[model samples]
Target chain A: MQIYLPIADVSVNWLLLLAMGGGVGFISGLFGVGGGFVMTPLLIFIGIPTAIAVATQAAQIAASSMTGSIGYWRRRAVDMRLGLVLAGGGLIGTVLGVWFFNVMRRLGQLDVIIAIAYVVLFGIIGGLMLFESLRAMWLKRKGIRRPARRSGEHPWYLGLPLKMRFHQSKLYGSVIPLALLALLIAFVGAVLGIGGGFIAVPALIYLFRIPAAVVVGTSLFQILLTMVAATIMHATSNHSVDLVLALLLIVGGVMGAQFGAIAGRNLRGDAFRLLLALLILAVGIRFAGDIVLKPEETFSLVTLDN
Target chain B: MKRSALALLICLASMATATAETLVTSLSTYRVAINSNYTGASLILFGSIERDARTAPRAGPYDLVVTVRGPRRTALVREKEPLGPLWITRGQRRFVDQPVYLAVVSSRAIDDIAAAPMRERLKLGLEAEFASPLPGPNLMGEDFVEAFIRLRRQQGLFQEDPEGVVFLTQNLFRAKIDLPAIAPTGLYEVETILLSDGVPLSRQSTNFEVEKTGFEQATVVLARDHGFIYGLIAAASALVLGWLATVVFRRE
Candidate 1:
């Protein structure tokens, strides 16, 4: 069945949309990460306008993050003090990012910017994950164990001024680095329509040395609020959000995540990371090919003031 | 002198009535409503040729050409050029106040109906549309215009059907027009021209409107007019759905 989208001004196949959402959702759950990055690109590939895909996916991200974070919130794993600071930085970054988004769209360069940003980001993250996973496999084969990480050691970021206490995580550090990281993540998230949870979890655990118990919780909490701000900004400033599209995606994602989590339990650590890394690298390479390969038709049309 | 002038006026009046012909046209529906289930719209347009009582029967067969034009819009055609590793849009030409949708239907092939010069002069085909000097800031070459027309045709926004109009009788005719779902909503003007032996005789134009109704209309209005409140509502609704889904799942 085909249904017309109100704000997007297009007709899309309902079953295809549900399947696409479910597929992306399953991958996200299997990897234990937000699927906004994959969802936006897939929507565009299926003929949804790029701006509409970006804006509508923000709402979908907000919903999935809520589902993931609420459990962590109830269990008292999230660091409220630090998460609030991060959300504050995220809110400000969203405004700046939306402004930049509008400017690029008006210049008719928004599509190129989104593609290039994806290529660069996926390349770095995918390459790093592959290297880390392969090294772990080689060390295990050689019967050499990796050194245990000491959470007690404070990184050099602790020496900065304006130190703040995160009592739940048992750490005291400057808010500058945390705020800066949140700003960068939220800004990129706004531009690319990604929740940036994968990027944030690592940054929090390795760079800031936050407790592993609270890392996912804090990242989820911050991302949930940041995406809420993003959805609202996209809806008001750009008028690109389609509520119907978001609803369909959320429904499919909710179901797919359950099945994925059950399947993920059977997979081991290094292999799972390796597969995910390959998937990411493949998507990045596809985007690169789109740019470098000669297109059949170079001429395109655009209605002005869309 | 006054007697001669009166005679000349009477002679001219009688000559006008001897060869006068006019067209009459009507559409099945004047408004096309767009809703959630809307795939596309098909409407029938009926036309007839009327002649003066004193006029003699035409020696040649009558030909009809119907042209449907949608609302005017500003458009741009862009060409990509390779820069390093990426192919980016580098050249652009703008067209202002051009029709967003166009469909031409006729009794026979346009080439068979009229010669090349006449077809272009009458704007009878897609290529003829760009041959005319369109209003724009830049007067680009024919290549850009051709690309623009080709792209629009591929998108189903521009269409041509030579044998679309069928004559029910010598005077009456019917034409079916199909508007694709991708067609922009706006006013559409349909013009029917009568031609005999490649010479245009009479023409008439009628207009209709395409607009979104009910829920779709409300959604678009809210997003465009009351954007702030719409945004807040959208966010709140998503959050509620999220909370509700998790609650339902946990109970199961």
Candidate 2:
């Protein structure tokens, strides 16, 4: 089961890689969000170089989202126009992200930077999700329905030039803010090796007011495109993608997602979010401990490329 | 003074006669083929002390020192300092053109083999290996070099075994060295020195290469040479796997 990764120049248990992929895939499928965020950290923990872990995780995200977007496409739920605009901005973001990644790597700061990004991102996202889900569950137990929102009051945000209408999502919005948000999401996604599904879905729903039905589909579509671009960029720029690692992860991920989807239907949305929030926070806290705690060995060595 | 000079001359003559012997050695495998299942390689270096019939026999039992030096590379060692809530790499030192992996296996403890000054001059062991010229000294002590050795040793890159070389007979000896799974791929130098009574009589050098073969080699070549295309293929395969998932496990 020991498989050597040519690009990373390391041998790891193939079964462990498969199980990790499967575990991450199950979480993503159960929650309908990306598992990429968790994978990079786990890969690094298991002794894969940070660059390889970050670059290779992008491939797994692309694979997972491909199935999702395709399914959504068949159901005619995806907003192709919006997805294209987001992906266009995503392409630019990915290039810039990869360049920055290269610079940080050369500086020998890639590991610390990645660790910081994961900790901060997971903390904020997980904390918010945990609070929101708990509050909703509490309100439901009290038999108090949330008040309805006033729809027409939020036109100030979408007020930008060059307005376009997305027929599938049934929204009129400026391409600027939406594209800019996609650019931001894609930038962090590429650097952190996440699909940015959770980030995009929330921003789409709250900021752009894109329908829940179309948001998941459109986000997955955009993610699929962006991740594909990210993977290609990482390969050309860093040459850190391990083909053996990627293949094993992809195989296990897809299989796990299938089972996870079936299991997800048995749980309520509130409970699922709470569980996911805990998982996210656990990963965040795990990293925070390493950062704050004194290392057993103060000095570490890395081989530099000629 | 006359008597001392006479004894020194006789000692030189005996040393010259002892140096007539030759050390001949060869590795079990000159080229290590790394495949998918490559964890590590265990290699045996078999050799003998070939002495001429005309020469007097060695006064004492012979000694052997085998040194295996892996490919050379630059390494950056960083020490972390706490900055508020986070620990960040604060100070760093660079070592250029040092062997990434090193293993010294001797018939006896390296210290017992020769005196310190002689060992240092010959560069015979791990201590002498790191004593080579380093870059500009840092504000911090020589702790970085020690730390580097410890780190590499933990990763199985650096090693020392006092009794690794076993002599099968009066003239035949063999040393075993195991290259861990994380061994760097490149030419590795193997050196064997034959010594007796604190005097080195003969030395031999050989080399072997660790190479990734077949699928491993192909992948490295593809990624290095055809980056863009390989990326496309990587991306395409993911998409295919994703599509296949939906097909095989269709949501009702």
Q: Put down candidate 1 lDDT per residue, A32-85, tens digits, no spaces.
A: 788887898889888888999998888888888887788678788889888898
* Regions of model 1 farther than 4 Å from truth: A151-153, B1-18
Model 1 docking category: medium
Per-residue CA lDDT of model 2 for A72-160, tens digit only, reads: 99998899999999999888889888988999888877778877877898899899989999999999999999987667765665778
- Candidate 1 matches the true fold with a TM-score of 0.96
- The residue pairs in collision within model 2 are none
Quote the positional error of residue B187 for candidate 1 in Å: 0.6
Per-residue lDDT over B1-252 for candidate 2, one digit per residue giving the tens place of the 0 to 100 score? 999999999999987876478888989999999999889999999999898765666787888999999999999889999999789988888887788989999999989989887788778888887775675564535798899889999999999999999999989999999999888889999999988877888889999999999989998989988999989999999899999989998868
lDDT leader: 2
What is the DockQ for all candidates, taken in turn?
0.71, 0.74
lDDT of 1 by residue, B1-252 (tens): 999999999999988756757899999999999999888799899998888776667778888888999888889888888999798888888888788899999999887777778778788878777787877755686889989889989988899999899999888999988898878888999988888888878889999999999999999999988878888888887788778767977633
The TM-score values for the models, in the order shown, are 0.96, 0.95
lDDT of each: 0.86, 0.89
Share of reference contacts found in each model = 0.68, 0.82
